[model samples]
Target: MPSPFRLRATALTTTALLLSALATGCGDDGGTDEDLTAQKLSWKDCPAPSQAEGGGSAPSPLPDGQRWQCATMKAPLDWNHPKGDTIGIALIRAEASGDPSRRIGSLVFNFGGPGGSGVSTLPAFGTDYDTLRTRYDLVSFDPRGVGRSAGVKCENDQQLDAYFQQDSTPDDAAERTGLLDNTKEFNAACDKNSEKVLPHVRTTDAARDMDLMRQVLGDTKLHYFGISYGTELGGVYAHLFPKNVGRAVFDAVVDPTQTSEQGALGQARGFQLALDNYAEDCTSKIEDCPVGDTPQDVKDRIAKLLKDLDAKPLPGILPRQLTQSAAITGIAQALYSKDFWEFLTEGLEQAYDGDGRILLLLSDSMNGRSENGEYSNIAAAGVAINCSDDKPRYSPGYVEGRLPEFRAASPLFGDFLAWSMVGCTDWAVPGAADHPDVSAPGAPPILVVGNTGDPATPYEGARKMVDALGDGVGVELTYKGQGHGAYGSKDKCVQTAVDGYLLDGKVPASGTICA
Candidate 1:
């Protein structure tokens, strides 16, 4: 829950289980000068989540006997300037429940968001940590410009409140101008407040910090679990430090090979498929469904609601009305997990009754906007990372021309998702090269997991990631499931395969498909 367009688990850090079927053994560390001198982490007793103080998602209570220790690592704000200004990298280590002498080195976890707070998620590892803590220490960190780290602050709670309610889909010239004006204001505020860190929060920068983290933890190589956007970060790390690659898994893959426009268009198609799946399920199961019996009916009803909101916003229980942006955000969030589909049904019911409270709350929850209007910097940092990583694939005129294609991709969500990229046209900084070849040569077998019906990151993206990694470098594990991520779902096959990999460095056979 960060950007309106992206969906991720609220608590689980990028959950990856990899059984490395054919990975080459790890090699010597890429011991550059900086790697040799990386500061050792000084661990201290962990503090309770600061959500009570008005930031971060409130994680579930820690499980019995699970102990958490906190630490800070100092990394160069700019990797290019090794002696330049430093920033604190917040880390949390979940001590292995098994014997210390038998413990493997730390396994670093990243729940994508580019803005997702690893510190916030560390406590909420829930059931998976129970098994993970028996083998290796579970370590997660806030990448620079993320929670606990020096986050990218742009707007206050009030400003973000107004921003989220602004029309996301710009139909005409006036609406487009309003949307662009708000985006410019948002970017300018971020530039003003976070000038020192904004230019350096690229995924590559975080990947560099990961090397330092690996060195500090005294591991010869990095064992990584990265999800969604975290996969992008992990891919960068693998590219930069192939020699240091250990057991790594990238789940719910974001294809590093695709341009930003392709990502958006691809997502539009994925979401439309998910919507169809949801519609089929709802009609068969839920009584009095708001969208009627067929997928076409569902698409029509939702599209009408979005267009109607564009013309006339609906008053919600909160002071802010439910605008098209908020409604779309709410809908996208529910698409992440089937468990939340009932919430979607309830929300649609409320929307039909002219009460926007449920839908508005869903949007806020997805954005990490607190009940009191406080906001996490997830959206701010997410944009920074996204803009810095790659150039936008479409210009304003190009996007306008491609509208028909996007609409074809997703009858309900395509236009809005496609237009979402327009903000990149006025980004504060230039992006890195788009869709560069990323093959971590000399790395162990990297397991890439994909959900067949993933909405945010389509299944094709996962296939693309494997293709980018080349034959034998990356192994593909397919889950015939529905959701943004596959590992945490009820499929015991994935969980068992992951366990096998982490426990014994086993990798599943290539092209292994599990349900």
Candidate 2:
């Protein structure tokens, strides 16, 4: 069976709301943009320890869904004080049925989000990921500060509603300043409100929580596949608990080593490349894809359209207009699935004319918001997880300085997208994780999968992490595919490679390219 691709049933989104809850510690650049430089920080740099979330001993498993049960686990709101009070962590389990005698211990999975929720996945992914379910009793969880488990909400729904509506791509100095100020305010609010939870949102805490789950589950070893940001979680696990590793597969991996600027730039370039792919495929499908005959032409033309939107958002069905931020929401959604490419074209066409329905739908999907005014717990957990994982440079002037370059590279949606992280600047109760180098020391070989044109987690990141892991154990398998997570999209070649690795522990031979 192929290793499962995480969450095709759900669309990608951002969890900016959590940042506002974390406002206590965000920073501003008093100096010029050039003054913003990567600071070398260490474990000592983490935020001060705080009070844990409900420290009543982590609760036991609860009846939840078909093939899965919920288990309440807990870790310190601060890992530094492991013996201190603990917070409840939501966990889910789906045990193998076919032959329990052949069980391969528990496999824990984390679908990445700075705010991604693992608990919600059981209902969405269910047995569709049977390969993983059939061997180990697959476990998923909502790390602290996520849905149905616990969260440190600072802003009310109305404030969050207001925040998402803010244009991501700032047009003039005023718009830019407004966005900056709003972000600072949001970040500051989080710092003050979520004092306890914010201090423990780091990946290290989540990883440690996972370790506690592993022990609680009675699994002697940890077998898992972590996609997108989940890759960082696995890397940290490997770095901290190498002895516990087992049959680990990191697909569409993240390069945890890069600085925030490098990371953002890498994403910008990846989106540019993915957009090139979209243009080619889009033009092949539609005779008039806006730009000239060439793909670059389409890219350039689309770039111009975004800039136009930024300057004067065109009116649409809803109160909001078509802005560069909205365009990006559409573009990123399309990059997630080849099937959604038309959404981008339709959105562009609507913008060319005057419609915002399709664009709003894309934004809705990107925001992971439901029609009922509520949002994804996955997104909520994602921000909690991301803000605490590794520090991103959030100086006030940072976005202003890099705005031009990001916009130039991602003309359709770059500048405001770059500014999307303003809330992190004032993140409170830091408690960040250590930069774990995950080489799977002395452990069995780890399979690293990459899709050629994965926009969110680029293929190059897979290569970079693989090379950095140094141990002779790293294996890279390139799927000549598109989109974000690629392990389970079902191109026979890709499926076969992953199946071979997961079942037989066979790493795809180096230089192996599977389409």
Candidate 3:
């Protein structure tokens, strides 16, 4: 089913990004009745969604759970020409639970993949909306080029599989060279295969789509909740339609202006910092962390493990390579969900035992390879979205040159993670113009959340985004949690403060720290 917040990517496409004349956006208090009337005749014919086989339409499927209705909202394929070539976004609307006497309107959610499908997030975030949903329709959708949307797929599935065969973690120069060559070939394939939608995957496109969704749902305003890349998406929408924002919450915000190279460099430091904290926690449960005693010791052992796999590929838990690429992917994925922290040791053990099973599973999940050896529809979109959203500059020497900074900042993940963005170096076009619209943001004082030790988005990033968004007049909410998105984790102290802002429209006083 097409989902919301989460999305997929596309191949390099043609851009006839002719700015279309769209109706004026809804005002800050959503819009006046006149605003609604003004927009009534503007919506185009949207493609109707196909019914999910054998499902009823309630909130979600809950014969024992709930049911869901497939909803579609029409948006311009390119917003600059709003009334032009139209594309329809699919949505799953989970209505409020309580008395209809007090409905809130709508709460659109974004789950972070830039490729993650958003359909399944309702049950996940529904609890928080309990009070709010009583009044609002919870709308979520997979952005264009993503699932359920007329998706963007590249290369026949088989050729795509061939690209995954390289040694993820290269031991010798030969494998590393081959990997780089493959990345270029892969990028070329994307350009040739899915060139139609690639140029249109910018965050601004998604933001405009959300506004269309709001009008279709008949909501006067947008009560948006964004996390991770989702936060970036929301920021773009707010910037584009500042007055349309009504009690929006941007958790784990992203500074879209930040380059992937800069982000990777910063993340190198953040991951190691988080790992250091994990190490402390690791020792409390397992003697020597079951990985290694000292931080450097653990790094050495993992490095040795990487080299071992480089020489001989193991029959990992999955059919992928047991290369350092596999291990690093596993580590990066684990870095986000502390609940999965225990898996690190297990992944380490399997790799250490020369099994390479657990690490493979983690790697596959990350790169979107399936167990039966099928690639996921999500990966195509993931790469497309990221490459298009922010065309990173990773030359042959980019990784090596930045190694020292990465190492100093993130002794554990510096080199490997920095190289991860290297794939983008070979991307055909540099990402779309960095949403020039984002340059000016007079959007309300949005709150920016940063964990003291978030691996994916550094604390510094949170600070940077908050400052950038409000011209250095935003509030920073720090929850001493360890995960990619912490707001929904039910950390009472954090929730109360965030809820007050959303429900009461009260900004946390300046310098609010929620730990």
Candidate 4:
């Protein structure tokens, strides 16, 4: 909930199972230096994910019995001085299953938390890309300041629980002051706890690290798959090293044209659209929707629930009540995927009955909390990177002034998101630009896939990314679907288009539509 603008598509399968138990459940950067790129990685069997990566078991082997391998690649801590101190970039891979002669080099992927741990995420969805692995080593890594890569650390788990529980949408001056104080305290903790890494975790720094990664991996060009925030990193890489890009694909594309404020506003509209779609889908079903009698009814009930919760909180996972902010966060989490819409309906139904378990569980997932109550570094690193990359810092007055416009965009989510713009307030380091520079004139044709109903990075971003990447550089493919990303949605048309391009170098015609 730190930077609501941050996009992530974490697996919710385990989360769904938890909900059935009691109707409630538990749950970077850097650069260069020739010697760094030439360093060898000692691949080993992956250990259980560290607490910072969101604790879980070691990744299981692929369906074909090929084991997943792990390694650490050293990269400069600061891109400005590549030969200075270095940090390890943790990596994971499943080698190609096909003939060595048919191998098309490593296909690197960034699953996009700007903080999501590729070291842990890739295996969770490994089988989804087995087709591509037939001819390429499927690879991913924990970007600097994430997971095992000297991950940025802020408040201790206890501090974070209190931080997140505080009122996020203030109704008066006292509440507003509390919100700003909390934001400042959180930022100060990040600076206090992660001063060494905070200033160096911008997207531009991560892009340079990818170039070094390509060299270390023995690939001539970086064949990449970027989703959500990953798309922004890819675009920056293309702009910085256009000629070195090869067979890249960006799904859930971020708009390179907007400032941090504009991006947040766009998310307001995008999420409202997704919520509308969710309401319509639920009510239009042959079976009666348990949450409401009609589409507007569904939304109306949800709005009233939020209003009621604001005034009087409900019991959530024991010892933690579901506050209004948590409910909104949970709702936003459920809207990320249509697959989770069932869970959303159930969560709403349960919340209405005074059982806040399901909704709070969803909120935990969004905040990177595990069933055992530990949190991943996703929140810390997301705030660090966003604050470092985004130049503008908004005052409480500015947010107050924009409330009307944000509310106009989304009555349910507007206040929550508008207040999130202050996540960077009183930060430790200066930001890099008004927005990322992604104009890559000479980059290869990068396939850009957009989902019509993506809540995080709205569909319009795909076309903007295509145009910004320069004509002929970004090939646009539209998936008339509902999810944060298309390829992962398992739409056959999307899979085929992406596989053809990444596997056989077959770029779909620009503006290709997949319904």
lDDT of 3 by residue, 1-515 (tens): 00111211110000001001100022232331333224432322223322211011223343224344456555667656555566656677666665677666778887666765555444435555565555566667777777666566765556655565465434468867987887777777777876767777777678877776777677767788887778878777877787666667767666566776776666677677767776668766655578888766677787677666556667764434566555666666666667667767777876677676666666555555543455545666767777777744567565676677867886556656666666666666567653323432545667677777777766776777666666733678888888666676678877878777776677887667767
Count of backbone clashes, every candidate in sequence: 7, 27, 32, 2
Best by lDDT: 4
Model 3 misses residue 419 by how many Å? 2.4
The pairs that clash in candidate 4 are 27-371, 113-116
**Clash pairs (backbone) in predicted model 1:** 17-498, 19-506, 19-507, 20-506, 20-507, 21-507, 23-445
Task: Tell me the lDDT of candidate 1.
Answer: 0.77
**Which regions of candidate 4 are displaced past 4 Å?**
24-31
Score residue 312 of candidate 2 by CA lDDT. Answer: 71
- Model 4, position 245, has a per-residue lDDT of 89
- Please give the range of 10 consecutive residues that has the lowest summed lDDT in model 4: 22-31
Consecutive 10-residue window with the lowest summed lDDT within model 2: 25-34
TM-score between model 1 and native: 0.92
Q: Tell how far residue 242 is off in model 2, in angstroms.
A: 0.1
Score candidate 2 by lDDT: 0.61
Evaluate all candidate structures by whole-model CA lDDT and list the values in order.
0.77, 0.61, 0.62, 0.88
Minimal lDDT window, size 10, model 3: 10-19
lDDT of 1 by residue, 1-515 (tens): 11246644652121110001101112224543563355677888777555411254434435665567888888888878767678889888877778788888888999887678787765665456577778788899889988778888888888989988888778899988898789889888888998888889888789888988888888888999988888888888888888888899999999888887888888889888888899888887756566566767766778888888888888874589999889998888778888767667777777877877767777876676765577777788788787777765346677789899989998788888878777666777888777644677777799899999899889988888888776777899999999888887868998888777876789999789997
* Alpha-carbon runs more than 4 Å astray in model 1: 1-4, 11-38, 50-61, 286-291
Question: Between candidates 1 and 2, which one is better according to lDDT?
Answer: 1
